[model samples]
Target: MIKIGDFNKLKVKRKADFGYFLDGKTNNTKDDILLHNRLLGKNNINIGDEVKAFIFKDSEDRIAATLIEPKAKVGEIAMLKVVAHTKIGSFIDIGLPKDILVPFKARTYDLEKGEKYPFYIYVDKSNRLAATTDIDTYLTTDHEYNVGDTVTGVVYGFQTNNSAMIVVNNKYAGVILHNEYFTELKPGQELNLKVIKIYEDGKLGLSPRQNRKEELDVLESSIMSYLEGNDGFMRFNDKSTPEEIYTVFNSSKKNFKRALGVLMKKNLIIQNSEGTYLK
Candidate 1:
């Protein structure tokens, strides 16, 4: 059965001067498949050679193929080696007769032949497979992601706002804000993170470390040290905001509130609704 918007395995039934004809018998409708020589090259495609091709509309609205290799598919991420560079784009040989085009706009840096680069494969408006370097714009899943769900990702680059570009699970690329990136990060660096938000678009928001119980303990100790350093009386309400808490403790306001709540409950500190003072 031939399916639209997908590749189908067809048997080469006959060879012609212009192309090879494939047979399709499904739903009692006989459809002729054309494997154009221009798209397939001069290679002799014999009868019964199972070829994988994507169905597309021809000039006459007939279902023809664009001759996609068995291995290549839409929404796939691959490490393809660059074969040639044109004025408009670079061509990658992803086991296809016609190398896939990675448009200049989709490229992050200059591509040279013999070098392998990771890219996401997608079908453009023209119904042709194209490669994109911007992997962040495409994400399509939503699982049970919590605030501290451990995740793994590769650092793509950085944003002007100091967010780190990361490809998580090769499913989607996302940003780990500079404030969220507590540790050092470099381009192409792979690290573990925690899920901050699972966006509606299926893109993930990430954080560097999971501020678990132990982490909170360390942060509480730091706050105590800061108070001790200030002669046991610290006026920090004016200075402690969400940003400051993140910068100093690598935690959120809720976490800080919880930590301070614990301290206050233990009578280690005193609060009078104005601010917290060391006791």
Candidate 2:
């Protein structure tokens, strides 16, 4: 049987001027899929040869088969680039002649062209090949992952609280709370995340922070750099607002104070109500 949006082993039944027709096991040629000559590469095909072809509908909505493997197949996840946008939906290049549509209803937000984001490929109810940014719905929580395991993921979106919704390893659902990260994360950005907790359903709670000592070191360095850049004086101090500290050092107010304390203990800086200065 020829299944659209999936691979099928079809037997070459007849030859045509443009290509060969692979039998769809139905009575007539109407269901026969066209396996174009160009798709066969340098290998010659003959009648009675069985080809493992990926089946899909072309731009014309006609059943087509290809020997070339797409970047991702149905029921899989991949980082696909948005190629075009339309009122109906956006299109993504799937390493095929006809790009796959990502219906607007399936998108969490408006996808910009040229930006690559992870998507889940699936056959819609209409039996059409489509991709979606609603990857959470497609990803499962069942995995062998454990807490403290480092995993890779792509930032797909942000919640109202600014937590990142991530597709871990392109298969599992994960999230990094806003407080767990000190930097701004954009959609489609790839990150190495540390698993802080595994939910009851197996969804991972992740963090992008490093060890306390390392983070302190980095924070102190950033403070020193800011001071040096400002002619050996810094405008922010322990009394600075949390927002100010975050904006300047991408850190929490408590961490900022700790870093400042470390710097002051080393006699590298002096802070007064006005601000801090190199000592």
lDDT of each: 0.70, 0.90
Report the C-alpha lDDT of model 2 over 208-271, residue by residue, as the tens digit: 8887899999999999999999999988999999998988789999999999999999999999
Model 1 Cα lDDT, one tens digit per residue, 151-215? 88777668888788877766665678876756567655677888887667666789776566876
Q: How close is candidate 2 to the true structure, as a TM-score?
A: 0.94
- Where model 1 places Cα greater than 4 Å from the true spot, the runs are 1-6, 15-21, 24-71, 77-84, 108-118, 123-128, 182-189, 196-203, 208-279
TM-score of each: 0.49, 0.94
RMSD, every candidate, angstroms: 9.9, 1.6
**Per-residue lDDT for 270 in model 2?**
99
- Model 2 CA lDDT for position 203: 85
